[model samples]
Target: MHELSIATSIVDIAWEQARQQGGGRVTGVTLRIGRLSCVHEDALRSSFDLVTEGTPLAGASLAVIEVPVRIWCGPCNAEFELPGIQRFACPACGHLSGDIRAGRELDLESIQIAPDQIAADTPEAKQPEPS
Candidate 1:
């Protein structure tokens, strides 16, 4: 599945970010998933677990925040959550419109890590040889 590839990319990005500041094991990753992103959360989590094995993010947790599909309705003069993908009409006035406001985000919000944790995970000799 593409989840594996997506997970791989996420890990790659997190790993690079962690490694940049000397080196640190990622503890968690926060992602914003949109309602229309069409990504399966369960599959993504499973793929993340499998892909993170043996990597810097091995024990990291994946936190996914669900985003709702919203549209701006001229009839109502406001934005409202869509009941479903197909119904793009104003809830109050029943006016059909396609003024989409949000719900297409697939982003990595942040990554958490501990410096000491990274040092502990690193090989001893690879570390500085006691000055």
Candidate 2:
């Protein structure tokens, strides 16, 4: 499954980030996965566990934020969440729209390491000054 490769990449990224800090135990990882991303949650979770074995992120928890497909309805002049992917149609005006506003993301939101928090796309946390 492609999930394995995905998990591998996640591990690699988290590992590099963690290693940059202090190689501490990673507590959790947050990801934003969209419905249109075609990533199986169960498989990704399982693959994460398997890939993290014997690694620094061995016990890191994998959390996913499921994002629904949002389409921009031109006639309605608004964005609506598509209930189903069978067709991209506006719920209110019933107009077909191919303008996808969101829900095609597969991004690593944050990394929760030991005590310090590494916020999204931010640089490394500052280390404490020696006494």
Candidate 3:
């Protein structure tokens, strides 16, 4: 799936950053996804998980931020959110314009990394090591 490829790209970028930084493991990744970007959030997340398997980014959380679709209406001389994909026309004047303001972005916002003890889940202590 394309999500697998997208996820692989994210990990590759994150790995590069980690390498440049000299250390530190990735704990989580934040993504800014636009509605018009056509990137499936669920699929992307799942792909990321699959690609991160056995890598430094393993167990990392993928957080997605939703961005709304905004367009500039030349007829109304105002910017507003598009009601839907089919309704790109201005709500007030009912005219269409090619001035698309936003809703076409796919960027990585930030990456959070923890030192050695990154957030990890483990089984019970098993009654301790017994000194």
Give the TM-scores of the predictions, in the order they appear.
Answer: 0.82, 0.84, 0.82
Pairs that collide in candidate 1 are: none
Which digits, one per residue and each the tens of the lDDT, describe model 2 over residues 12-64?
A: 99878888987666768889999999999999999999999987677678888
Question: Residue-wise lDDT of candidate 1 within 9-64, one digit each (tens)?
Answer: 99999989888877867878989988888888999999999999887677678888
TM-score preference between candidates 2 and 3, better one: 2
The segments of candidate 1 whose C-alpha lies over 4 angstroms from its true place after superposition are: 117-131
TM-score for candidate 3, please give it.
Answer: 0.82
Q: Which stretches of candidate 2 lie over 4 Å from their true place?
A: 115-131
Which residue pairs in candidate 3 collide? none
lDDT of every predicted structure (CA atoms): 0.83, 0.85, 0.78
Could you say which candidate leads in lDDT?
2
Which model is ahead, 1 or 3, in terms of TM-score? 1
Q: Candidate 3: lDDT over CA atoms?
A: 0.78
User: Residue by residue across 8-105, what tens digits does model 3's lDDT show?
Assistant: 88899988887777667887888888888889998998889889989988878788888888888876779988877676787778787668888887
Rank all candidate structures by their lDDT, best first, as comma-separated numbers: 2, 1, 3
TM-score of 2: 0.84
Residue 44, candidate 2: how far off, in angstroms? 0.4
Model 3 regions more than 4 Å off: 117-131
